[model samples]
Target: MGTMGMQGPQPLPGISHVIAVGSGKGGVGKTTVAVNLAVALGKLGYRVGLIDADIYGPNVPTMLGVTRQPNITDNSMMEPILSHGVKFISVGLISPGDKPMVMRGPMLHQIIRQFLQQVLWGELDFLIVDLPPGTGDVVISLVQTVPLTGAVVVSTGSSVALQDARKALEMFHQVKVEVIGLVENMSQMVLPDGTVLDVFGAGGTERTAAQFGLEFLGSVDLNPSVREGGDRGMPAALAGPESNLGKPFFEIAHRVVSRAIEISRSESDVLEIS
Candidate 1:
């Protein structure tokens, strides 16, 4: 721990696939997707790590059900908490809910750098970074610290989100980061009669992807499982691989794995990090 009781970085890494999952704005379910995506990839038997990059609103710890403070060594490195079979760390664990991140840009950058370089994330296959809504200091620090494997943008089927989603992609472009694709979250609602109601609307993610020349990962239904599983600290992909919501997320996981989208290593160098 630092002199001010601030959590520092993890130990040096033997990890791959540091992904940045982001949203143009909040309420787009970026955290939900990030948590479940890590869990889904873990199901493939990969050693996964989830870093709650949302310094302002640290929700990944809650979604991952990590409540314990990270352990610190005399060397000032943090040992991430283990939960849901995945190694994890979050600023939320260090700060109470009442305290928001009001530090200057340098402090924020330092905190992000600590998480990336100093943490002891031993031999992880994938480190899914759940960035805060919108492009800001956190995202800048993350991408600036290390070259990311790719970035996954989460958006809804609304023009408002769509507009900001474009800006989000532009942020990635400005940073020279790869845009993996767009995920259409809360795609629809499954009626009791087994019909699909496009509540948030349909094809918004697809349209956005088409315009940006990025692929459309898939659509996530507004299943209660996403909510319940998140609250229970189990990703929906674990509970409902057969459910409507699960199908899309699982498929997205497949896409991420199949194409070798992230990770700079060769096939021989690639081992399931989990």
Candidate 2:
């Protein structure tokens, strides 16, 4: 089997910018960040597509409340399920419940390629790929297949999380993919009695971003409503911009867009020169 390393990067049709939301390890709320960013971008009037590329643990379908099977077109392309003004596809939608996927690297490559090529994602301004945590086969396959505009690394405020987050950042750099910025999730929390708590510690993620000269996108507080919204099949970002729970996501989305545009322009310049 030919790896993405063997072939030139292939751009997805009808998608302008491809953003991968990933983490160095699991349980960092990477999927949640990916979902919220997509939703927030949609709310800002950008036509967006979201791919739940976390094949092993595809919870995006459940998180977005899209349990229905996608429609197949006459051309045999799978239509993306639309929700909250964004189009999305997840392996969870077609898979038979939480049964584990036991595929090797080759199988993983084919699936990722099919998701990009066979899905009829029609004229998307942005395609947000929710990748599995870690620098694994899937991540390598994706970066090789698509000329990603950039990547967003997500991490919690803990030291362990930062260590993994650093690994993720280094992986992106090694692959020549632009690290758009870092998003620190579950950074802070407030008690019912107005007492604030730094449950996992604070500012480490931002400091790391600064150390690496990357933009510190921002942090999202550890809000109960974030989890509650996910359980309700409604990400906090879709709760509208005025919502306290949703505001941080919107802020992050704005930074992501700005960075993506900057990267695109830089690429265009180099192409023109070459």
Candidate 3:
């Protein structure tokens, strides 16, 4: 995808693809999807990194079970913490505990830029940014800071969630970022006795994706094990791709990699023509 901002987006050195995982509104399990996606990509043997850009509610460290602060290199760059085979950095690392980050727009922009440029991420096949929900300052700051390969929007199957999800898609479109696809999280719940229940109503997210002409990556069930795993700081994706809990994330990761490659190739073609 083409870069944003007047000065244009700067590419991160040694990073092949940078993907942002976002949603229009909160409470849709966006961070869960992002964390699992990064872990799944790593499980698939790709080097991965994750950035918890949700400044106000930096839940990635909790979900990843990381509480250690990053080490500062001799050159002053923060070294990302390694967890579950993926290197990552989050505001939670710097300021741990229940205290909130009370800051203004300029401070938020500076923090985002620092996370993008000041971290020694080394080489990564994919750097997944878990953005705060909504079409707000963090999203704008991200695009202005670095060139994104594409974005993956997460939403539940609820119609109300889809309304905000549409807004997120529109925001990405307006910013000239290629939306890689839409992933429907907590789409359904499998009850005992071989029955399926539509917890948030069925097929709404996929329908929304079709309406926007974007790929419907896949659906994830609302399993209690998934919740328990997240709470226990072990993502369900650690079960590996062949397991039931991890298969969906692996499937989504596969589609995401494919879409990113397509976007990169298309951008190359545009560059050639220009």
* Pairs of residues at least 3 apart in sequence or in different chains that clash in candidate 3: none
For every model shown, what is its TM-score relative to the native structure? Answer: 0.88, 0.95, 0.96
lDDT of 1 by residue, 140-250 (tens): 777667767778899999889988889999999998777878999988888889898887767898998998789788878888878888887777877646766566777
State the TM-score for model 2: 0.95
Q: Which stretches of candidate 1 lie over 4 Å from their true place?
A: 1-13, 243-245, 262-274
lDDT string for model 3 (1-274, tens) is 3455357678999999999999987989999999999999999999999999887689888788887899998998999999999899998887788999787999889988999899999999999999989988888898888999999999998989999999999999989889999999998998888799989977899999998889999989999888888888899999999999999999999999999999999999999999
Runs with alpha carbons beyond 4 Å of true place in candidate 3: 1-6
Q: Arrange candidates by lDDT, descending.
A: 3, 2, 1
Lowest-lDDT window of 10 residues in candidate 3? Answer: 1-10
Task: Rank the candidate models, highest TM-score first.
Answer: 3, 2, 1
Clashes of 2: 0
lDDT of each: 0.80, 0.89, 0.91
User: Per-residue lDDT of 154-247 in model 2, one digit per residue for the tens?
Assistant: 9998999999999999888988889999999999899999999998877889989999999999999998898888877899998877888889
Predicted structure 1, TM vs. truth: 0.88
Candidate closer to the true structure by lDDT (higher is better), 1 or 2: 2
